[model samples]
Target: MKKILVVDDEFDILTTWRLILEMEGYEVTTASNGRVALESARANPPDLVITDWMMPHMDGVAFIRELAANDSLAQVPVILMSAAAHAPTLEHGNAQFRRKPLSIDDLLDLVKHKLGEA
Candidate 1:
């Protein structure tokens, strides 16, 4: 099974994503902030990461930079989600962007595409 790490400041959002992804047969892990998420990723690197742009302690972009800095985790695919009016600039080629209020179907499709299961 593909492993996914989902990070969000909102506990409700994190829980919702976990349930949705798990139901799709993906092994899912979640963190409430980027700092915790980064630690989790280092401990057990995930195949893909779904993160919110704005987070306490560490932001998604910073987390992605840290993740990419690690040789072992550098290749992990990431999906960045934000509700902000303007999207943040992302230079990583392995990253994809999605606006907030993301549709479950769209999220699943992106995950599948990233994991090459689509």
Candidate 2:
């Protein structure tokens, strides 16, 4: 099964994503912030990372940079989401940006596409 790490400060969102992804047959791990997620990823890297742009402890941009710096985790694809209208330009090529309030079906489709199942 493909493993996916989902990071979001909001408990509800995190849980929702975890449950939905698991139902789709993906092994899912979740973290409240980028800091925790990075630590977990270092110990056991996931195939993909889905993160929220704004988070406490560490934000998405900083997290992506850290992830990219690590050779072990650098190749993992990332999906970044935010409610903010302005999206930051990502230096990483393996990441895709999406605005928030997306439906579960759309999210699943994106996840599949990111994982090269599209």
lDDT of model 2, residue 77: 94
Going through the candidates in the order shown, the clash numbers are 0, 0
Query: Candidate 2 clashing pairs?
Result: none
Ten contiguous residues minimizing lDDT sum, candidate 1:
88-97
- Judged by lDDT against the true structure, how good is candidate 2? 0.91
In terms of TM-score, how similar is model 1 to the real structure?
0.95
- In model 2, the runs with Cα more than 4 Å from the true position are 116-118
Misplaced by over 4 Å in model 1 are: none
lDDT by candidate, in order shown: 0.90, 0.91
Query: Which digits, one per residue and each the tens of the lDDT, describe model 1 over residues 1-118?
Result: 8999999999899999999988889999999888999999999999999999999999998898888888888899999999888877775669877899999999988988889661
